[model samples]
Target: MSIQRRHTAQQLGDCFKVAAELALPVLGRQSRHLDGLTDIKLVHGIVSGQGKLSGLRFTHAWVEGLDDNGVKYVVDASNGREVALPSDLYYLIGEISPSECVRFTPEQARRHLLDAGHYGPWCGAPFEHEDPVPGVAA
Candidate 1:
């Protein structure tokens, strides 16, 4: 069965924190056995779609994991709900271009979080030309 989109009325802007929390545990091997997933990663990229982020190509974060059957999925808990979508569907809905995304392994995420001191857009994020939104750390 296909996973349906799950979200609440809450406005979503904390993609980084949510994604990091979900990714770190699995990537660090702290919760790997819980779901039988592998090759987990934290993905950061520019996205544009409906809701709060509509009409803007802003930096966003999410986690990706490969299931036992080798199918990839995107797990997002940013909008006050946790939803897991097939990778292709997630990318299509978000209008995410793979070439513009940066994927981080557990080790890289930890190192970057330590060195940068934040969840991040990290270096080489695609939002260089976009003006920063007030109260948003992108």
Candidate 2:
């Protein structure tokens, strides 16, 4: 009998770490405004998979902000991706309180990644696992 091994998507800190670092300068200067609310400080959140990927959750980090016109935008520094914040995994971490900020170190970041079950080398594939459809393979 032969054993088959499947590959998973690649996990790198370039997107997450770099995005946070790059956005910090802008975040310090800008504030996001929501509909009926006053301007509020921007935040760094992890967007777990944005485009069309299978059921796999790949963590792509981005910063959320509002333009002067009150339009919301998500900025990705790794690729300079500016788009409207999707209604998906926008988890905010490193914030102790609404007014307090906690910058995550390399160790802390690794810990969170491990806790999320996303620490390790991946194959850069889209789907985390095969589709459930009958005999459908990715």
- Top-TM-score candidate index: 1
What is the overall TM-score of model 2 with all chains considered together? 0.35
lDDT of each: 0.70, 0.34
The segments of candidate 1 whose C-alpha lies over 4 angstroms from its true place after superposition are 1-12, 26-34, 127-138
Q: Candidate 2 on 1-138: residue-level lDDT in tens?
A: 111223232333344434434344432322232223222222323233434433323434444545566654444445434334422322332111222222343344344434444321112322233212123221
Q: What lDDT tens digits, residue by residue, belong to model 1 across residues 15-61?
A: 77667778787423233322777898988886775765466566778
Report the Cα lDDT for residue 44, model 2: 29
Displacement of residue 100 (Cα, Å) in model 2 is: 20
Residue-level lDDT for 12 in candidate 2: 32
Q: What is the lDDT of residue 10 in candidate 1?
A: 30
| TM-score of decoy 1 | 0.75
